[model samples]
Target: MSLTRSQVESIAHLARLDISEAELPVYADSLSKILSFVEQLSAADTSSVEPMAHPLDGESQRLRADEVSETDRHEKYQANAPSVTDALYLVPRVIE
Candidate 1:
């Protein structure tokens, strides 16, 4: 469950992070501890456990009624818009 300096460097490169040489040892030790935790988690017996949608219960999360009950002030909302066309926000074109 130990991580090397080179492995840490590779992980940093893949994550787009700039890690200095002095920071490599610190990162390697931290990564090694995480790997050890994963190894410990792998030792768990999950064969008898049923898959659950939630930690407390498998029931779906509560949600508000789908029917619209409130009205929005569209004119006030659009007042602060930087650019608007036909009651809609105008965004910069990203594609040709």
Candidate 2:
């Protein structure tokens, strides 16, 4: 499929891109080729083919459960806060 100058310009406008008259022809050819490839791909037969996540063949790896727990140093951290009371950070209330 070949794309005309006007069609290419319209596509550029829709995509929010600016292309000069010279660049239009280059983009037109490239876009037309891509559209043609898509059309060809649509006509291909793949009824017996299975879909794959990746083109490269490899099995997913599993990791062992390493239980590492984290502790919060809230008291030490909140001690440096400008306004903190009873282990809670205080902020100015915006809702009136």
Question: How many residue pairs clash per model?
Answer: 0, 0
Off by over 4 Å in 2: 44-96
Candidate 2 lowest-lDDT run of ten: 55-64
* TM-scores of the candidates in the order shown: 0.49, 0.44
lDDT of each: 0.90, 0.87
The predictions' CA RMSDs to the true structure, in order, are 6.1, 11.1
By lDDT, the best candidate is 1
Model 1 agreement with the true structure over 1-96: per-residue lDDT tens digits: 999999999999999999999999999998899889888777888989886666767365778889998798878899999998888899989798
TM for candidate 2 is 0.44
Q: Residue by residue across 3-96, what tens digits does model 2's lDDT show?
A: 9989999999999999998899899899999999888777779899988777666755557688766588888888789998888778999699
Model 1 residue pairs with clashes: none
